[model samples]
Target: MADQLYLSLWFPNFRFEALPAALVSVLRQFALVSGEKRVTAASVYPISFTESPVYQRIYVNDDRAQSTEDSIIENAVAEATEQLHDDMAYEFEMKWNLWMPEGNDTPISEAALDTLWRPHPSTVKILGFGPHFDQATYEQNGHIRVDFGLDTPWVMDEEQEEVLDEEAQKHVQQNVEMLLAFTLSVEKNCGISSRLLWTESGEPLAEKLIARLQRLN
Candidate 1:
């Protein structure tokens, strides 16, 4: 069994957005709501495809998410998958950071959010040049990485904890469900398609994962 799971959500018609700028906007909005007087900011870098023409990361130190935190990962994944199956069916990788600011910014509209992200023509060329963006050549030529991390409190010691034990098994199952849900939400909100790839090479676990997610629907 793999300890960590890797999933990708790629946007086919996704016009690449300047995520750093958008993140800055998001954080600024957060500050406004929290009543923090200091100017909020983020560290933007191109962790992937840096040498290339595109920049893809907007790093932040804040512990808060852009939306409600309860089962957020799950909701995002489920919603995203439903949206994808309903619309474009192409495969995708998830690398972007998504956060919905907290406030009564509701009537703001997606159009208003569009101002934060600018389209990059170079990324369009790079993505469209390949048949599937997940292919080896595309990954090499446009080597940009999107980073997302899942944090939980259920920690165990290798010397004492047996993974197959009932409690341990339950924790593992919860993580898997959260990953799937997060992927779905990304697709739903971002207009992207996603696929989950296991870091550990094996067929049985992968099959089991697919089965579980399918059963979820």
Candidate 2:
């Protein structure tokens, strides 16, 4: 089954006052890896995730023209973290392209499988936690968390009982490489003390990917 994926990052001796800079660094790393320089939106949630955002800004609105400065990683982070507090969370959304299968009800033939998958833009969320937000959830979720949404792009339709052909394997491998590169970049560039890539189902993603690749071999 496909599961939600997340990357948790912890910084050494992190201080609450440095969250905005940390958030900007992480977002900049994301832009470098994903090639999507502009943050689409940003939100500041007070107390917990259950509460409505105290501050929200959508840069991609159709009614407003986005200025060059408006999308800058530093500017977006500054805007969202302007009302920074120990009981709030800051979230930024950005786009990253990944190979995904087009929606089709019919079973795809091996020869047509390659044509069904294409590089599509996916929204990824990078959130920085305040010390007291969500009851100090950062102690477990890390100081910063990246929500990559679904794990489908990495493993492909595992439940379908379909074997990946060479072309299909190529696309899947590319997606995995992109993910690894991004993870490495974030760790290397963001001054992260430790990082973890996890799934909502509590299953290790590496094991599933290894199994899938073993089948391909």
Candidate 3:
């Protein structure tokens, strides 16, 4: 038998289990929501793990789920498989302590669940690319250089757009902006202990788009 455990995301501040309907709707891609504003993506976090979570349960809905006596590994896959009606892949998010698969023996999917713990393919990847942009500070020279990137593989040319297309180009630009916003929000959450800061765009862009973001901000 293989090991498995529950997988969950913990938001200590909010009493509600952090699962949001919008986030679930975008399960095929990344979804970041701070109050009202939101950002989305395709494959934001990817995980290829040697081991599974402490709990092997995976849920595909907007609601938090638990493992049942009849809920075996095959059943969980059936659950995730049922939700695969859409066009893309998605990672699983578990609220901390609610439910997770446990283990390290073999990848949870193939292994039979002897214990409650088993590997969830989605959990294996979500931790690699955290649900949100987790900020990491790097000190270079005398300044701090904040760095961030998508947790999952950022798909650049899914539809063979590697060639050339106006719509594809615009989509690529929007993707970059989405990633940038994720990085910025995470940086703000870090304990900077500062009252004021300046902002500027490091990349070149059309003047019109730049002005639009500024106006909206």
What are the Cα lDDT values of the candidates?
Answer: 0.30, 0.82, 0.28
RMSD of each: 16.8, 3.2, 18.1
- Full ranking by TM-score: 2, 1, 3
Among all candidates shown, the one with the greatest lDDT:
2
Pick out the ten consecutive residues of candidate 3 with the lowest summed lDDT. Answer: 136-145
Q: How many residue pairs clash (N, CA or C atoms closer than 3 angstroms) in each of the candidate models, in the order given?
A: 22, 0, 41
Tens digits of per-residue lDDT, candidate 2, 163-190, equal 6566767777777778878888988888
Q: Which regions of candidate 1 are displaced past 4 Å?
A: 1-4, 18-163, 194-206, 211-217
- Decreasing lDDT order of the candidates: 2, 1, 3
Specify the highest-TM-score model's number: 2
lDDT of 3: 0.28
lDDT for model 1 comes to: 0.30
Q: On a 0 to 1 TM-score scale, where does candidate 1 land against the true structure?
A: 0.35
